[model samples]
Target: MVVQTTNNYNASSGELWPLLFNSKMDDKKPCYLLCGLPKPLECRLPDKQGGVGSTRECVSDKGTIQQRITEWVPGHKLSFQLVKTDLYFGPCVESIIEQFVITDNNQGGCQITRTTTFKAKGPLSLVVAIPMFIGLKAIHRYVFSNWKRLSH
Candidate 1:
């Protein structure tokens, strides 16, 4: 068994993650991580307008992360834990924690950086670790693209 992951973030003025964290949409529905999965997009996210909240919805079956608010510093930083992607494998995937920071770039803009670290709980996690890391970077690209579209 092997795990592969990739990660990265883009620099921008306004922070999209913080916006989602503070959104007041109906049902408090957050900007969820879209699972390339075919089903009801019930976005896995915490229940800001419902019952007991869990750090559960921040992961998807299609190698993605969603609604998670682990550690927050208002406008400074936030930490989100992504749930494992593979659900059937005996070892599955590793849980990854992403630390996002928003800072002044000294150029009249803000730099948004995301640092992700992985922790394997079971199975042969090293065999495909590279691929898993790459996958994370792939996802990060999508994140930025979406952010760009939303910002515009």
Candidate 2:
């Protein structure tokens, strides 16, 4: 299953990419999605690195999720695959991959498209599909709203 969302911004991709991928967590508010299920209390890149093969750890009250960067194109795209997660949904979810693509719009700004792919475990896949999509859509919108606000 996949949940994807796109939003336009008045800022260039260069200006917005860092806001989403590289900004310091302390410089902004903590990310909290619906029901606090995947709330990330902290997110950091090891050794201040940013690129393919680099790892990122997102820690929350529930548990930590480690991701390995699979693709990195500065100012245009970024992608990562979940290496391990101890969150509540870990057992039901087999693998997760997230990607963000940015493209310049004719209006001198840019559009960001976020895609989240989920592979579920067994019969639970059918049961969790709808709810997972809804939750992820909400999460994408929440993040988009913050990006739109911060880009200015």
Candidate 3:
């Protein structure tokens, strides 16, 4: 199952991409918090941009997940492939890919779309995707709200 959450903000990609790319954990904190991840989020990424093979680790109250960078386009897009996750989901979870795309808008700002794809080993895949979809949206909204307030 593929779940997507999108957001268009009044800020330019140049302004937003740095915040997202530089502060990966802080960028994801809103969703993690809404979904019950505690304070002090933990995230680790390689110091070098070794292209697709670069690995990352993210830990929250929900659990920990390991990911490998699949794509990286500075100020444009980023994508990661899930290598492992503590989210058992009845052991039916096979893989997950999370992507964020930033595009320049003609309206003088930027549009960022987040797409999360889930591949399940069993029928319960939807069980994980649904809540995740909702949580992702909530994260986007929170970010947008804060971005607006801060940009002013």
Candidate 4:
């Protein structure tokens, strides 16, 4: 399953992509709390070039979950692979591919388009994808909204 959205974000194209890539989040707030534990927060990406399947771990109240940056092209493309854990459902591999493209909307501002791809495991993918999408959308929205607030 793949989901995509494009928003103006009311900011300049040159400026927005960098901020999105390097999420300048302050850990002192409730939103930052989401980044920890049983529920995945925002990702904390690697600062340097690393090979495939490089895993990053997170600890939650439920258990620990792992993520890896499987692909990259710097500002233009990035992907994260979610490692399945015994604490979640059954066997599963999930990833989100985000692309930040700059386009001239031809109005006054520019557009930052985010495309997300969701890939699942075996037979139960249909049942699982729906709920998984719901969670991802909600979390993504929360992070963006918080970012807006902080910027102002």
1-152, model 1: which lDDT tens digit per residue? 22222222344434555443432212221234533321212233365532222453433333333435577665566666654344332154456667667677666556566677765554556654655565556555445444444444
TM-score of each: 0.58, 0.85, 0.69, 0.60
What C-alpha lDDT does candidate 3 achieve relative to the native structure? 0.65
Candidate 4 lDDT trough over 10 residues, lowest sum: 28-37
lDDT of 4 by residue, 1-152 (tens): 86666665555555554455345444433344334323433444454333356554434344554557566554344455556555454255455454445565778656656566777677887887886666556545555665555444
Mark the 10 consecutive residues where model 3 has the least summed lDDT: 19-28
* CA deviation > 4 Å runs, candidate 3: 24-44, 48-50, 88-90, 126-129, 139-152
How do the candidates rank by TM-score, highest first?
Answer: 2, 3, 4, 1
Q: Backbone clashes in each candidate structure, one number apiece?
A: 18, 0, 0, 4
Question: What is the TM-score of candidate 1?
Answer: 0.58
Give the RMSD in angstroms, all C-alphas superposed, for model 3. Answer: 4.0
Query: Which residue pairs in candidate 3 collide?
Result: none
Task: Indicate the TM-score of model 3.
Answer: 0.69
Query: TM-score: which candidate is best?
Result: 2
lDDT of 1: 0.47
List where candidate 1 sits over 4 angstroms from the true fold. 1-45, 49-56, 59-68, 82-90, 121-123
How would you encode candidate 2's per-residue C-alpha lDDT over 37-66 as one tens digit per residue? 464455678657789999977666679888
Better lDDT candidate (1, 2): 2
lDDT of each: 0.47, 0.78, 0.65, 0.53
Model 2 alpha-carbon miss at residue 115, Å: 0.7
